[model samples]
Target: MKYDTIIIGAGMSGLAAGVRLAYYEKKVCILERHTTIGGLNSFYRLRDRNYDVGLHAVTNYAAPGTRTGPMAKLLKQLRLRWDDFDLSPQVCSSVVFPGHKIEFANNHGEFIEAVCAEFPQQADGFRKLVKHIEEFDELDLSQEAVSGRKVLGEFLSDRLLIDMLFCPLMFYGSAIPNDMDFSQFVIMYKSIFVQGFARPFAGVRQILRTLTRHYKQLGGELKLRQGVQEILTKNGKAVGVRLDDGTEIEADNVLSSAGIVETHRLCGTSLPTPEPAYGELSFNEVIFVLDRQPQDIGHNETIVFYNNTEDFIYAPPEAPIDTRSGIICSPNNFKYVDSQQLEEGFIRITALANPQYWMSIPDEEYYPAKQHWCDQMAAAAVEHIPDFRPHIVDTDIFTPRTIKKYTGHLNGAVYGAPHKILDGTTGVENLFICGTDQGFLGIVGSMLSGITIANNHLLR
Candidate 1:
């Protein structure tokens, strides 16, 4: 069998690519290893409860009829209606240090005011920084790469304020957290702060469903529970793919949403052995099923970017899990529907962890390590959210190994292959790469990545 285009991985990027091509009436097929779609943004069921795995909160929000920002562009490009995503603005979120705390309101003015009030000495610098970010052209890859830390330093003298400003943005997007690229930092600031954060009424699965429905409506083929074993190439051009089941299917083009190294491996001898230079970061996430509403527990903040230590470190730690710096989100606080429809509210906590350490642990030590980290994180949460422990009705934990198994990301790299600008090329004609490895992060960014590759490579 042959297709006009064969897209590997049915993640956000692949799905968006499918929607774009199918919208153009191309015969496209999206292949996935998993039984379901959404990749890192996918969800799972736990007995009677349904938990969204990847999304703590959907960022980059744009209001209806406004049709601006990344989310607006995504919806407009995909021919999706504004009603497709029922988004509610976060009541409040914050970045907290030992002595200072900055609240982020959904409104741009309020957030700016909070920042200015907190750092009155650097208020002028902050305004100029935001102006620069607003004016920065995110698509201009020709712009040289500079360190995010360095850029912040140039504007603000306070290092902690820099870390505070970066806490949420970096966690959401940056792979090299300590020293993120200025381009990335600019894009993220615009996306998160300028555009703001909102929660989807039906959660992430709803967003996936919306994309899937649109693709199928456009007559695209979606193949789940099946994956490509190899890229069938001839004369240094990708002509087709062989399924894991030994079936050979041909295509004029192969667009891979798989990370760069993974896509390179599919190209046979054209590429060298995979040496992922971009240091990958993995995380340990635990979800707590709370018996009461977040507000009732004295946790009114919608999302909190926090750290126990005075300093911040973004890289994967080689030592035992610190649980020092991480994000805490209360889903119920932002749930769009009536609080009564939900039987219980939930709180999620995440911390950076060394994927290598988890991989090297003995089989006997696996559960022990997981338990140790789970307890450590729970204890750490009390420092930020005082009511974290008492409301816990049930708990679920996911480690690096779980991420690797579920997403097939190398070493459980959550954002995948770091931030290098690749031209979606593999020295193999008619083959391209997108998604995380393509330098776009977050749900909106990843979808845009697919649309980008489809428009630039497939359509052109």
Candidate 2:
């Protein structure tokens, strides 16, 4: 069947694009391989308990009634309301290194003050860096690839501070090892430190359901269990897609959230030179379901980014899980309205993992390995936060293999490719890429990625 656009994958980028396109009365269909939507940020139930797959914190949080920022603009573009996301701002979060700790909330000024208070010698440089960041146009699609670390070095003299700053940004968004694309760095910095983190009281389902319902009301077609096998092309132009069942659907244009290298390979072609490297940055998400809130144990921070060693290492670890550095998120700590609270407490820890080991692990050994690492990772995490093992009633863990199974990313790279196609262009005339490899980051950025690509390329 011929149509206007067939968007592959039902993740944030794909769904948001579907909603935007459908809102304009374009014939649009979203094909999701998974039975449900949300992609990496999906939700599931096990033993009668709900769990979020990829959500740690929804960064770039803007309070309700706010007229600007990514959050507000996302709502505006999709024709959604401010309360649709039900975002509760983070109470506070911290970055803990060897001898220094910097705490920040939604206030950019407070974060700046904390940084200056901790690093008295580098205060001038830090302020200058902030000023430069404010002046820099990180949204320019034509901006050349520059090193975030090198740029930080130009302003800040301390390597430790640089690494600390890179820790949270890299863990949450960086695709490249130990460094980030400068634009990406700015985008993430602004989203996290500037705008800060927040979450829906109902978890990822809140945002996913809102997007899904909105898209359907706009007459968007959502087809689940329809896995795309290939992109049907003619004379180097993408016409549509072939489903796994060999059902071919035609469209005037094709948009993909399948990642850069993976998307090109589906076309039976290679990306023209400077061949994009497959991302190796994947992590093991170990979630502990506790009997009580983390605050009961005196661990009240919204999130903690900790590094045991002097220098922060952001690369794929040689070990099964790198507990030396990781992210600890207590979903129970957000400042929800009406004193809303989750039924159960959750301590979700994400640590860099060796993709090769996890992806190649024997099916028989998977659960055992997960259990062993879960125990070990929690041990490392207790050093920076209150020990919650006594309170954990149940535990769940997923690795890079799970990421690949769910998202189809090579090496289960959470952020897709090391290189980004900022403009979403491909060699094929009507084929484009969005989501992770397109370079906008986090939930807010990812949703905006879909809207930007659709507005720029498809809906014209």
Q: TM-score winner among the candidates? A: 2
TM-score per candidate, chains pooled: 0.96, 0.98
Query: Which parts of model 1 are misplaced by more than 4 Å?
Result: 272-278, 335-341
Give one digit per residue, the lDDT tens place, for model 2 in 101-141: 99999999999999999999999999999999988898899
Each prediction's total of clashing residue pairs, residues at least 3 apart in sequence or on different chains, is 0, 0
Q: Candidate 1: lDDT of 205?
A: 82
lDDT string, candidate 1, 1-460, tens digits: 7799999998899999999999999999999999889998898889688888888877787777785678878888999888887777776888888788988756778788998998899899988888877777878746777888887888889888898888888788887757678888877877777777777866788889999999999999999978888999887788989988998999999999878877777676755445456446888999999888777778787888887677888888876565878888877777365543345778899888888888778989998889889989888877888756776788998888888887788778888876564466666778888898888888888999999889989998
Please give the distance, in angstroms, between residue 410's alpha carbon in candidate 1 and its true position after superposition: 0.6
lDDT for model 1 comes to 0.83
In order, the Cα lDDT scores of the candidates are 0.83, 0.91
Best by lDDT: 2
